[model samples]
Target: MARKWAGTAIVIYFLILVFMYWYLFNGDTSLPEKWVGTAADPATFLNARELMLSEQYSQIRNFMFFAYNAFDWIVYFFILLFGLSRVFERVAASQSKWRIVQAAVYLFLLSLLSYVVTFPLSYISYNLSKSYHISTQTFSSWMKDGLIDFWVNFGQMVIIVSVLYWLINKSPKKWWFHAWILSIPFFFFMMFIQPVVIDPLYNDFYPLKNKELETEILKLASQADIPAEHVYEVNMAEKTNALNAYVTGIGANSRIVLWDTTLNRLKEKEILVIMAHEMGHYVEKHIYIGIAGYLILTFAGLWLTARLMNSIITRYGKVLKITGIGNLSSLPLFLLVTAMLLFASSPLSNFVSRYQEARADQYAMEMLQDKDSAITMFQELTRSGLSQVNPPLLVKWFRYSHPTMLERIISVENYHTVEK
Candidate 1:
């Protein structure tokens, strides 16, 4: 019966992929405003070649995004139905007499299998970006990064999963609540260490090489009342052609980081405007707010997951080979339920993120008071990244953390008008 369902799921997955490929690529890529440029430089508005490339790139990227997520759910579902989790559990039991050691071994084995299963799709995604001339990473470099990501993520997952099961063993009824409480600190710890420890594993970060530009950015930070002592730049040119800058971490770890691509591609004024936007995030305390919001959602999601997992186990425990809520064999079901809930709640999270981003944009304009540079910066970003100015409604809802390029440009153009 599980095989029948799995076969049906595989069929449905391919069908959805076909539909997405058709729907995304065939849709109108036209913008609302025909000309985004002044009469002086219409090419800035829409270079035909660039627009075509952007559309193709966006189409493929959007397809892969949904496909990867859908397939991830399917993979977890397959593991649950096929007794793969049970196999891992037995394997772990054979290796360790201690339950905690068994749990760790089980999780490690499961994670290894999941990584192997998912690597092909990830590789394909990387190759697609490379084919589009967006990613500059070599195969060896990309593979190294992939291994690093897998291990880092697996380590974190082991910690969370172990604590979660321990809580379940202690108080099955209130474990979700307890786990959520513990996650509050864990979340912040990850954010705090992310910049200082985890980030350097992938790319080299250094204080901005241009002291003059760094001084100007420091001045902007001071004006924003940000206690930023220095600006940092990451070496990203070897990995991608994309332009990016952002504020990350909290308290002492917090720093504004510019991708080397951004520094190399953009003018000084544009860089300042970008930095101002990042500083807006810091000034408005968006990081803490975002963390708070995430924890709140996580609290609810965990509670729901616990309820849903019990209900599913009650009905399908024998078939799934899940002995109980606390059983190591139930890990796949736990993961599946959590993944489904997260996917469903993505729009809500994305909406909050977009709102925060818009506020940051507003704050940037108000601080810098330079609409032209702001507009041009986004334009250059769009051009260099070959990003679609406007994407599909579904994509925007599910995927966009910031306003679309066109929306951003229009907002900046109308900023003064709205103020008046």
Candidate 2:
């Protein structure tokens, strides 16, 4: 019976994958007819083309990326379903406050094991980035950041898993709903603290040193009604040659951040155009909307997970060596279900994100009123970042949060129709 149910579960999981793929691939992917001059400049177009990976390089890189993801997923599923988690639970069973200790130990082990298993792929990726002239960080600096990330993630998982199990024990049948409710505040708290507390751990941040540039950026923010008082500069050159800027945090914590490399590399006009894009995110309230969308998805995902868990536990409780949902040993099973759900929902999440990004791009073009600068800024970004002009359709659906650089350039080039 357990074998039968497991087969059913596998079938259902694959069916969901099939549906997601179908939905994502069926979308219209053609460029607009009005986007005529997007790549009309021979020099800019050739520069963008040069930034793209060679056919052979792209194949190898894409293969490595896909293989790494597949390997990671397999390792996770094997560890969880093959009873490694149960082994960890048994190791902590003799302790006082065993459940809490078990949760902590299990999570720590899980995180450590994941990192260890995935490190080879990560190392390869790092080498690939360096070979492509993307990364600037030394191996030692990379390892340091990796170590910091491990501890940070371990601590975070311990807190979250502890709360999750506590809620499960408190209301075995309705814990999913309760956990969903609790996660709303927890999610916001993480966002609120991330820029101030978490980010500074990895790199140094300072107020933007270019006073004239900062003044101009603030003026742009004012024009966008973003309520931003200052711009920040992060030491991204220490890690990567790539340039980036972003809007982060909420309310008083809200600020625009630029990579120091961006300041050094882009002209004043180009930098202001980038600032306008960041300000666009703020003015459009993408953060708040993103949070709301996440919460809704979390609610649905948790509810589905609960249903799936109950069914699985009923059929394979003894076979999987788990008693019930509230059991501390059930963490791996719970995680497996949640991870699968999240993976299956990637297209939906990416769709929303792409929409938000497109809107922000449009907003930036309107606010800057400098189509030439916007186009040049994007071209510069594409060259510096080694971004693909156009990724394959499935890649864009599954992985891309922003429109392809080609799509973005075309949209801005044909701004009048895009705004409509």
Candidate 3:
């Protein structure tokens, strides 16, 4: 009877999710009416449109993205339902450290298995990017990066699983709160070190070489009350032609980084406009705000995960081959529930991101008072990145971290400055 009830609950939950998906995606077919700015030439717009929204390339890419996501969920479910995770746990059960070694070994095996299962889809995605001329990474270089990424993830997973199991065994009832508190410092530490440490592992970064451009950017930064220091440029030309710039790190590690492609392709005015936008993130303290929001979400997610996992294990521990909530063998169940929770919360998280991005755009426009440059910068961004001007409403709600290109262009076109 309990199993029947659990099955019914599962069915209802998925039914609701399916309905929400349908509601979000149904009958939403809108495109931007026009482009903005003096540089928005018809030829450029047409080419960008063809690249972004054409049935041949962009549509295929979008479909592949959706299919790949579905495939990932399917794989996870297969691992869980077929007792594969249990089999891995048994293989590692005799390891030392009283479950610490077991947890590490289990996570290592799980990570390796996941990589093997997903490698085909990963390869397809890369090949598609290459075929579309969006990726400049050679196959060999891509494989090298993939290996590096796998090892990094494996190391991180080992640490995370070990800590989580420790917490679980130490205080099963309060581990969620403890984990939440512990995660705050670790999260900030990662953010602080990412620009200086992790990023360099993948790409080469250098101080922006153009003194003239750097001087102009520093002046703009000073005006915005952002710290005027060195601007960094990354060597991304070897990987792709996408134009991007951003502010990363905090305090001493904080700086603006521009893709070399942006410097090579855009005018000085456009680059400054992009720089101003990145500075807006710092000036407005969006990073700190984002971190706070993430912490809150993490707390809630952890708390809920604890409750659900406890209940599920209490009811069906033997059936699922999980000894208890504290057992490292239950990691797959924990992951499954966490994935579902995060997937459901994606819209809310994306909304916050998009809101901050819009605020940064407004701040940049007001500071620069160069609507033409802002407009043209986005036009170039859409063109160079082959970004959709207006994606489906569902995609915009869930996937987009910034306003759609059309939305941004229209906002700039309609923005009116008030006299101070």
- Best-fitting candidate, scored by lDDT: 1
**Model 2: residues with Cα > 4 Å off, grouped in runs:** 1-65, 416-420
| TM-score for each predicted model, relative to the true structure | 0.96, 0.87, 0.89
At residue 299, what lDDT does model 3 achieve? 96
Better of 1 and 2 by lDDT: 1
Candidate 3: tens digits of C-alpha lDDT, residues 1-420: 435644655575566556555544453444434543333332455564455343245445665555566556655555655677788888888676566678778888888888999999899989977877778999998998899898877777777788988999899899999989888888888878989988898899999999999999999888888875899999999999788898888778886899999999999999998888888887888888898899989999999999999998888776666778877678888888888788778889999999899999988888888888888888888767666666777667767889988778777878896665
| Preferred candidate (lDDT higher): 2 or 3 | 3
Residue 354, candidate 2: alpha-carbon lDDT: 90
TM-score preference between candidates 2 and 3, better one? 3
Q: What is the lDDT of residue 360 in candidate 1?
A: 90
Question: Which residue segments of model 3 deviate by more than 4 Å?
Answer: 1-28, 32-44, 48-56, 417-420
Q: Model 1 reaches what TM-score against the true structure?
A: 0.96
lDDT of 2 by residue, 120-186 (tens): 9899988988887778999999999999999898888888888898898888889999999989888
lDDT by residue (34-59, candidate 1, tens digit) is 54454212256657888778888888
Roughly what TM-score does model 2 have, to 2 decimal places?
A: 0.87
Clashes of each: 0, 0, 0
